[model samples]
Target: MILTGMIFQFNKDSGEGLIMSSKGATNEFSASNWIDTSCEPSVGLKVSFEGSDTLINIEVLKDESISIVSDNKKYSASDEQKMEEFSSVDEYIEHFKSLGYKLAKDTDDGKVRTASLRRFLEDGHGEMIITSIDSKITVKTMVNGKEVK
Candidate 1:
């Protein structure tokens, strides 16, 4: 869920903050260090941490179990990206499943119909969620690899 809050303190030395949530808990998160948002939090403008614990970007705080965004700098999506590198169907299923995607048995031509906890991206090449065509090449999926996605 998206957690919205007010910034109590911003420790520039650590890039972490003491955030007082609307729901009533102070969360300490590494802001500039762990996640760099286009809109930096200014004391009490209100902020959100959606889906995951790491506040990689400033997401709209909403009343939902999950949140969506086009892209964010902090969370690397290469880890969820998959191109058909299957020796066989089982291998393909297992590999993508490892990446949190489930093969659509009914739509079994070779596209990820749904993913459990994954959002696939190609950085600049393309997007993975929009295709069912089996591709032989794919970008490496890395999260916080210290390399720009």
Candidate 2:
């Protein structure tokens, strides 16, 4: 069976790692199981693999980078023109849902709030990363690494 999950723990020296599947199962894996040679395994890297006891034929999945900086307000007029700001997190979430995207992950740790939405396409997938802190909301949407909406 094929399992999709994220690498929650990885040891570069040992070349061993653990995958936390979307269904909440934890599976161990090693470097040999990693099929993607282009990139090294690291924590928080999404992957797909086949196995039950030990994961094999591991493949890396596309993931976008998110940066939450304090100086986010320094955006120039051009930058502001490119950005899509929302009044509230709920409003932002609803906007993506209206665009046919489903909420993939969400986290709120008292200080920071984040929501990740995704839309699967025939060729590739689209992702949106939303972050809100101190009443400041930042939204970034990408399709196969190319920024869109």
Candidate 3:
């Protein structure tokens, strides 16, 4: 059976590692069992393996990229006018809150500020990420894992 998990522990000297499967089972693996030559074994790397006690045919899993589809609705003249009304990041966040979206994340560094808002959809979820850098603000939206511009 093929199982997916992350490499939680690895010892470079011994060429051995341990994988914690998504199902919570921990399995042992070694360099010989690894099948992917593109990358070396490391902790926290996602991988898939086939076996029970000792894993075999272990391979690293590649990250999936989200595809963005262009949708001009968010950039309509009325929307642009509304966006320009916000004088601060707080006001920008409040605008989305008024539309029933909830703040999912907020981060600020010395140079940049970012806020992520999310709302539940009938099928999946809708998310909007707003960023402010040097008094310039940009917005990106995604629905069901696909980004919509």
Q: List per-candidate RMSD values in Å.
A: 14.5, 11.2, 11.9
Residue 124's lDDT in candidate 3: 35
Residue-by-residue lDDT tens digits, candidate 3, 1-149: 66666676799999998776544456788999999999989976767678888789898754421111121123222332355456777887888777556776799997999998765422234557889999998887766446765
1 or 2, greater by TM-score: 2
Candidate with better lDDT, 1 vs 2:
2
lDDT scores in order: 0.42, 0.68, 0.67
Residue 15: error of model 1 in Å?
Answer: 0.6
Better of 2 and 3 by lDDT: 2
TM-score of candidate 1 relative to the true fold: 0.33
Top-lDDT candidate index: 2
Off by over 4 Å in 2: 1-84, 146-149
Candidate 2's residue-wise lDDT over 1-149, tens digit each?
A: 66566676799999998776554456789998888988989876767778888788998764321121122122122321444666988888887776555776899998899998765432344567889999888887665556765
| Model 1 lDDT, residue 9, Cα | 61
Residue 83, model 2, lDDT: 40
Candidate order, lDDT descending = 2, 3, 1
Off by over 4 Å in 3: 1-85
User: Can you write out model 1's per-residue Cα lDDT over 1-149, one digit (the tens) per residue?
Assistant: 55555454676766667654443345676765334244665544345664345555554343342234323223334444425665444554566555444332223445543221122221211112222336432333323222224
For each candidate, give its TM-score against the true structure.
0.33, 0.44, 0.44
Provide the lDDT at 52 for model 3: 85
Model 2 lDDT at residue 23? 47
RMSD of 3: 11.9
